[model samples]
Target: MTRRILENSKVLITGGAGFIGSNLTETLLNQNNQVTVLDNFSTGKMENLLPFFSRKNFRLIVGDIRDLDRCREAVQGQEYVLHEAALGSVPRSVKDPMTTTAVNVLGFVNMLYAAQKAGVKRFVYAASSSTYGDSVSLPKVEEQIGRPLSPYAITKYTNELYAENFHALYGIDTVGLRYFNVFGRRQDPDGVYAAVIPKFVKSLLEHKSPTINGDGSFSRDFTYVENVVLANQLALLAEAPEAVNQVYNIASGERMTLNELFFCLRDNLAAFDLEIGKVNPVYGPVRAGDIPHSQACIEKAKARLGYAPVFDVRSGLREATKWYFENL
Candidate 1:
């Protein structure tokens, strides 16, 4: 894939005001792409995109994907669509499955239809690690997915199905990236469904004891945000026809227990504040719809999409800790 493909190209990012979306927006804008952000701001914070407001190549359209007409409007004239908008979190989906299905599943179909109608070149979307639910596999492969454990996981899995069907039925190129515990700067730490990393960082920063949902033995392949952005970029620019219409694991290809993650953060953050290393986490019951462990086999992605993760968990954690310490 050449840089010229993204340069001066019109790209639309759904949920552009959110953490991953905002990061992608910044990267694409820096690369001289004309980027349009479509976000409803439900979970996405406006502050995330504040830095890009003045950029001439950046545009923000406050809209929801649940509305088909709005999806059509966002897809128009856009050569590529990076669909990142979704209601994320297992507990949130369990509490409100209807809304989750509406946004993640129905909204996904709306985007696909609109993008197909608009003749968009590629549709790259966010799949989830939760799709490996109940499988108990050490290194998850793309083909061997288990039944979804939560409504959120179900919605993401359904998205892969829809994207594949869209490709088969309509010939619209699609790529699904199964993200594994992505974390970085600008990740929200104050919400009910806040991800573990940011939430832990925030609690430790405030000198509050972070709560571990389980025994801290549950592990994840905590990939960094920049790696995910690279996967999206490569998926958009992939030349091989075999790479299109397939799913790839976007991860660091390593796993760390929650306890290990906690200590790593503490040790890293201790450089800024000596007292941070002393903070201990409170262990609690395991949350529902969570897998015991997760790791990824990235050979498929390496062979197909040329994805080489730039940051491992420890390095990514160091970078993320620095950002949270300074920004939060």
Candidate 2:
């Protein structure tokens, strides 16, 4: 196992009550770091943070990112900032661009500016694969990107630009991790804008048919949350001048169609209950702002940040399925 790079530090996770944020907080707390979470709990669940409520090292700030004072208060004396607080979902963005822009764009700037003023060592924020809109590439790369297809994508790409500008102008070190479809434990499956993996798992568990937005042939580089956590750590560890102030794709480096993903989830969960295997999927119209395919070229991350994804999609699905079966 690679050694843990971040330990005994004061770190702040902006969306600490959310799935990826909670996972990062849990791991960091165990590694002997003092972790604080700033979340308004709009989409984040208190259930996710309930386990850590009693921990002396864990502090919770009940505030929204759109509030600059809250953002400033959260970053006080923090060595690093994992900026994961942003409104997600392309469909939701398409539905209400104003709300998405306010939170994902304006709120993002608030957090970034806060981290800068506090003299934080490194600011690592979550970018998105949606930024690779309409690009007909097999494996998406960092330097190459197409026009954003959604407001959410625009916000994420804007974040990249802001981070770069911040680094160039203010000299605050920043790293942007362009995460693909991230999933795992603590990922909420009940919301209207629920992610595909957990939503599918939840549906099958109830013996209900899950609807595929497209023909199910659209592929994605579905990354497991554990790999994303590791990438965050690596991004923190990468102190080289070139490594900082840049974005890297945090993904499995493999691709699978939505149909294959559904079957994988079905087959994995079916081992516990055969009824789950009998469940069928319903087809629906294609959603706006969704690309036909998405895969990542991890060579840059591997070479620059020494990031190697430890879990493939199937292995991640197995782990995520077991969690859903037990917890859901």
Candidate 3:
């Protein structure tokens, strides 16, 4: 017999066509769980989920999570709700704070309210590593969150707050996973707001110079997408009542600098006999609302949710690089 989460669950994932959401959809469907994905296609693409378009257990809704009726409809009869829809990018958010706030905060509240009213078994959301904003801590723990630096970071922190309030007032089981720099397949490499890994990998593959946003000393805990999936699975399945209404750091529990990541990507591309272009990264001033360093402890997730991230940066990058080579 399969686990309850696998056997009888109908999961709803907002933004299910984006990089992390699409990967999570693939994982859940593989686990024998029914998955309903609601995406607006603003950043999410149908190509990201083209492989699963024919699966009976998978359903797709082309809608925005910001809409109350859509949110309510998506939450109806769902066992677990994984809210991943949001405008993500510090620089982009800094440029247009209103759009970020509307999507990340207002959309989050709409989803939470809808899920709570629908009586979903658990509500888990994608928080960000940016929540540890100005804290100069080396390895960030869940309990010690600093002031948010960017509009995006503030919105993520706001998600945690809304989740906690919903859990407390409405008896909704909510867990927030503060994800670090998640990277892997299906990540958009063309957008100006694309993440670091995909952007660098795409640039390197295209024989272009990858731009470093700041001095190379800035570091991050670049978590893989698989670890995030595992964290969400645990958040949905964990039976401990104490785990409700809390936040957990979802990461690989390691750290690497941007310069280090650049070289690593270069080397991986080189392995394919793809002549690595000159590693001349154009330097720019540090962008606003960006933290200098970030690393997650992940002990809370380990002890509470049994979240064991299987892949570190190197293993994850190898797989990601292979995917980029094959797909891009």
Local distance difference test values of all predictions, in order: 0.93, 0.93, 0.88
Q: How accurate is candidate 3 locally (lDDT)?
A: 0.88
Error of 2 at 237 (Å): 1.1
Ranking by TM-score: 2, 1, 3
Give the per-residue lDDT digits (tens) of candidate 3, residues 55-88: 8899998888789999998888898899999999
TM agreement with the true structure for every prediction: 0.98, 0.99, 0.96
Q: How many backbone clashes does candidate 2 have?
A: 0
Pitting candidate 2 against candidate 3, the one with the higher TM-score is 2
Error of 2 at 54 (Å): 1.4
In terms of lDDT, the poorest run of 10 residues in model 1 is: 1-10
Tens digits of per-residue lDDT for model 2, 98-205: 999999989999998999999999999999999998889879999999999999999999999999998889999999999999999989998889999989999999
Off by over 4 Å in 1: 1-5
Better of 1 and 3 by TM-score: 1
The residue pairs found clashing in candidate 1 are none
